[model samples]
Target chain A: MMNRKILLHSRPQGLPTEDTFKFEEAPIQEPEEGQVLVKSIYLSVDPYMRGRMNDSKSYVPPYPLGEVITGGVVGEVIESRSDQFSKGDKVLGMLGWQLYNVADADKLQQVDENIAPLSAYLSVIGMTGLTAYFGLMDIGRPKAGETVVVSGAAGAVGSIVGQIAKIQGAHVVGIAGSDEKTDWLTKELGFDAAINYKTTPNMKEALEKACPNGVDIYFDNVGGDISDAVMTQLNDYARIPLCGAISSYNQEEGSDVGPRILTKLIKTRSMIKGFVLGDYADRLPEGAKMLGQWLAEGKLRYEETILEGFDRVPEAFLELFQGTNIGKMLVKVESTE
Target chain B: MMNRKILLHSRPQGLPTEDTFKFEEAPIQEPEEGQVLVKSIYLSVDPYMRGRMNDSKSYVPPYPLGEVITGGVVGEVIESRSDQFSKGDKVLGMLGWQLYNVADADKLQQVDENIAPLSAYLSVIGMTGLTAYFGLMDIGRPKAGETVVVSGAAGAVGSIVGQIAKIQGAHVVGIAGSDEKTDWLTKELGFDAAINYKTTPNMKEALEKACPNGVDIYFDNVGGDISDAVMTQLNDYARIPLCGAISSYNQEEGSDVGPRILTKLIKTRSMIKGFVLGDYADRLPEGAKMLGQWLAEGKLRYEETILEGFDRVPEAFLELFQGTNIGKMLVKVESTE
Candidate 1:
């Protein structure tokens, strides 16, 4: 049989383009001892991938050139040579963007599609869910009646965070790019309020009207001017969980200048903490358990923006920068049945 | 008795000038049923008071126009109407910039001059020492072998933070404005390294050379460009205890813009927290116990730039912005023989 894969062709100067990815084909390999030959079902494309394309030191190393792009993938074990994974089992792992993957059974975690769909593992119950869980619960520590303002409120992680904050009894406010997103957050997700950044001329005034008691916690995903606006409204002892800065990801380094935060920070006595899900690697089971319980109890809800076909992976990844996807952006590869 | 006090005549557009103060003389106040007549021996003029000069809201309300500026004062109780205070007792309280103050005995904290000196209560054993202790211990949480970088290293709180970090066996580096201050930090206070920021052309390069292990904790006292440089060298999981931003204290609001820290903060997974000593008001006794033990053990030392005479109060306060004082700046109002 034949397998198709995608590789990092070259690093883009600004926003990544079509030339950044290269297509390839190879003969499918058989599963070795203690391994499984898995057929890819769905792959995730996230904002953090932009940081890896650069040749700089971070929490994780930068991606190497001419290599299969590594990301979260949900697949089916077509052939298993290990006792851990049986044939036809659904599994999830940090695997490459390929049609088929031959990986060690130990590297893949068996996921159940019985509770939710196969794409749900890559969205609501996987890394995306865990990222929102730890960042908000551990860092934010929302109190009942306290105001929580989340940037990228309609996006995957932010959507989960707002729902969890609501479960904790916090008055949640969302900031998104479109009126549709704001309406969905307020009407469907039960957010206390929502602000459309594209339509609103003055966010500070809108925030003042929305958060009458002042912002107690800010879950930052799209940083820059949006973050600068939120910083001005922080109440005393406000907590900020810094997850991503997708707005400035394409701006390059040293040029993302804004108002210095030290003054307002000192004045309000606020704290802003930058974190990734990897920071809570040891507590993954705890987070996953809570997320599962919440989902089963119907206390939590999630959204997904899936693209069909493996070839549309690069296009789906590019759409993240344009704010075209509302939730977890996933690309479906093939059918297992 | 004639009492001399200064009033905030007018709010300066930027930095306070000679025209800001108005001197007046009134009869010394008599102690009421719950009050004590105290003679002010020494008064403190700190950088934090500058924030109060503006009409903006902060931790405390802005200093009222045409009113006496309140600050730390050490005085002698000449007359007592309350059972709490006795004659010849030394007490400390937040009192006006005046020679005599008639205050309620409940507001004054008794100090033992025999343990240290009269000025020591206003410096090491008073709010200055407590601010350093809590900001470093509670927020910074320095571990042994960690590299700690302190800006405004020779000032009141910065000097104390360095000594405390040294007691924890951390490698401490200080950034100050002059050779005299830097020499005092390294030669006297036992700092591992010190940088004269005014003479150093590139603070980032100097910091890199001084901190080869990268900065684990940054105790920021001076903000603006100096803080921007410190932000670049933070190691993974770095903790910054934001104490003060004396660099831009004189500049009016909204113009102190610099590089945004979100990207670097996310990359390094660091946390920066701004705090005031009031945040630990409930634990003042706990901090006082630790500071008193360190001082009695000879593990800590202090510096005070004492300007003689009550008339020099405003001059001493103005000198704070000029960076003329190496440590705690004080004005001697009177001597009790």
Candidate 2:
């Protein structure tokens, strides 16, 4: 059978263009011992992928040219040569950008679709969910009645961060790129206030109006001027979880306006801590179980911006940088059945 | 008896000048019911005092114009009306920039001059020592064989920080403002290496040469480009204790250079924590007891830049911002005898 795959033709210099990737087809390889052939059902298009496309040292190595673009994928095991995975079982693994992947069965986690939608496993109940869970609870440590401000609040990881802060009885404020996403955050996600960063002329003033008590916990996803504005309103002993800097991820070179709040941090006696979801991989099951329980109780709500068809994965990934995705950005490769 | 005091005559716009202060004399007041009249012997000139001179909101209230500049002082009780203190007893308290102070006896800590020198009570065996000890141990948490880099490495606080890191079995690097201070750090303080920032063309390269493995714990006393350079060399899970930002303390307005290395912090998955000695005031006794033992055993060495007379306190403070003082800056008001 022909297996279609998206390959990294060249590393991106700045923002990635469609030309950076190439679509190619290959013969489906038979699953060797302790391996399963996964039919890609849903693929995650995330902001962190931008870092992997750069030829620089990072937490993980950069993607090599001519290799399949690496990413998280939720799929079904169509064929298996190992006792670990069974045929027709739903699984989530790092299967990259491909229609069919011969993956090690040990790397895949069996998923129960009855608990939630299959796509949710690649988002809210997956890496994005765990990223928000550990980054907020372990680092931010939002206290009851404390004010929490989240950047990229309408995006996948941020949406969950706001909801989790709200569930913990915190006054949550969200900063998003559009008015529509802002309304959804406040009206549906139970956020106290939402600042549409695109329309907001003065973010510092907006934050002041929304959080009068000053931000006690800041879950930073977009680290540029938005972070600087939020930092000025931070209360004494504030905890900041530096999850991602989506604002600067696409830039080829460093900006003149870097994170300008270090002196303010010293003055307020606040803390800024950086973290990644993979760092806490050992505790993923613990985070997933808690998130699963919260989802069943309807205490946590998530939104997904799905782009239909495997051919449109690059377009979906591009839309993430443009802030076009309302929630977790995902691309559908094939039907679950 | 005539009591002399150094008062803040005018608010400093930038760097404090001689005209910023006024020396005045008045008749010494009698001790009230719960008070004791103490004669000042050694006065501490700290960087935090510069913050108190500005008319702005801070952790501590700004010192009013024409008021005695606030600071910690080691004194001897000349007259006592309270049971808490007795005549001829040496004590340490916030007696400000004055030759005599009528303060509540309960506010003073009795000191044994025989344990160490009386002046050491205001420095190495006192606040500066405790600031370095707790700020490094509690916040930095350096592990054995890890690398530690300290800014203002020859200053009162930073000097102690490098030594303490060495005691904890970490390879310590000191960044100072002069060649003399750098030599003192490496030869006298037992630092592995010392960088004279004034002579060094590139701080990042100097840091790279000193710490080949990258910095694990950074004790920041002077914040600005030095801090920015040190931050770039921080390893994963590095801890930074933001003790003081002496570089920016004298500036009336904020600098244009925002913390340019904050993005590096996220990439490195490090932590920057701001701390004040006052926050850990309750635990002072614990740190003091330990530091006292270290001093008595000759495990820790200290240097003092003693400026003669109470009138030299303002000049001594100005020297701190100019990076002229080596180790702790003190104003010797009178002989203990």
Candidate 3:
């Protein structure tokens, strides 16, 4: 069977273009002992993928040229050499930008289709959801009646963070790039207030108005002026959970260092914490169980901005840096049916 | 008796000048019910005093013009109308910048002269020492064998922080302004290494060489490029206890923003926490007990850069901004004997 894969042709300097990714076809490899051969269904295109494209010091090593671009995915097991999975068993694993992959059975998490859609496994019920859940609850530590301001509010992790904060009885304020995203946040996602950062004349003033009591917890997703503005209004003992910095990811080389709010931290007596999901690997199951329960009860809602076709993965990934997606940006590689 | 006090004449634009202060003399009024008259012996000159001088918002309100400058002080109770204290008792309280203060007796802590010295109440056994102790142990959370780096290393809070980290079995590295301070930190304070940032051409490289293993806990006293440099070399999950930002206190007017290290924070997955001593007021006795025992056992040591005479208080405070003081800066208001 033909196995289609998108490979990194060269490192991206800023915003990745279609030329940076090369799609190739090959025969699907057979699964070895203790491995499963799977056909990719939904491929997650996250902002963190930008870090992997560059050869630099980071939490994890960057993707090298001439290799298939790697990422998280939900897939259907086509062949299984181990007793852990059957041919039709659905699973979630790191399958990269590929239509098919040979993954170790140990690395793949078996998905229960009866509980939620397979696509939910790639967004709300997966790493994206867990990242938002743990970061807000653990680091942000939003208490009931406290104000929580989240940037990139329409994105995967941020949307969930706002909803989770709301469920926990916090006053949730969201900062999004567009009016439609802002509406979606307040009208659909149950956010208390939403600010269209692109249209807002003064984000600082808007944030002050939105959070009259002052922000007690800030779930920072876009780390630029919006984050800076939110930081200024934070109350004493405020918690800032650094989930992502998508705003500064695609800046041109030699761009001036963005606004610093560390001095503000001292005055406001706030705490800014940067965290990774892998760092909390030990607590993933606990996070998953809680998130699963929330999703099952319909208390948590999520939306997927899906890009059609496997060849569009690079474009879909680029949209994240440009703030073009409404929610979890996902690319549909192949039909499960 | 004539009561002498320093009044805030004008708000400081940058570095405070003599014009910002005005000396006033008034009659020492009789202590009212539930009040005691304290004759100031030692007045504490701290970095946070800079924040209190500005009209802008901060953790604490600014010292209003025409009002006595607020500060912590060790004083002798010359008269008391309350049952809390008797005549000739040594006490510590927020007495402002005054030769004599009619304060509520309940606010004062009876000082034990047997424990080291009376000045120790404002140094190693006082709020400064407690700040370093709790900030390091609770927020910084340095693990054994880890490298702990402290900025303003030879100063009041930083000096105690280094010694406490050393006592906790961590390799301590200190960053100071002068070679003499560096020598004192390494030779006298038992720090593993000390870097005089003035002589060190590359702070990142110096820290890398000293730490070998990236910094685990950074007790930040100076917030500027020094903090930025240390932040770049921090390990994953590194804890930074934000205490004071002395470096920016003397910046020229309109030069407000400091270095932007949010990106670095996200990259390293680190945490920066700002804490007020009042937040841990309940735990002060616990910290004091531990620090007191450490002092008695000679496990912790402290140095005071005493600027003699109450008239020299403004100059002594200004010297802190210039990085002139080696340790806790204090002004002798009156002789204890």
Top candidate by lDDT: 1
Instruction: Give the Cα lDDT of each candidate.
Output: 0.92, 0.89, 0.88
Can you tell me the DockQ of model 3? Answer: 0.59
Fraction of native contacts (fnat) of each candidate: 0.86, 0.62, 0.63
TM-score of 2: 0.98
Task: Give me the candidate number with maximum DockQ.
Answer: 1
Candidate 1, residues A1-337, lDDT tens digits: the string is 7999999999987899888999999999998999999999999999999898888889988889999999999999999999998899999999999999999999999988788888888877888889999999999999999999999998989999999999999999999999889998999989999999999999999999999999999999999999999999999999999999998888878789998889889999999899999999899999989998999999888889988899989999999999988888999885333
Q: What is the TM-score of each candidate against the true structure?
A: 0.98, 0.98, 0.97
Alpha-carbon runs more than 4 Å astray in model 3: A252-256, A335-337, B251-254, B335-337
Query: Per-residue CA lDDT of candidate 1, range B204-260, in tens?
Result: 999999999999999999899999999999999999999999988888777889999
TM-score, chain B, predicted structure 2:
0.97
- Which tens-of-lDDT digit does each residue in B102-129 have in candidate 3? 9999999999898779989999999999
- Backbone clash count, each prediction separately: 0, 0, 0
lDDT of 3 at A114: 96
The collision pairs in model 2 are: none
CA deviation > 4 Å runs, candidate 1: A335-337, B335-337
lDDT of 3 at A167: 96
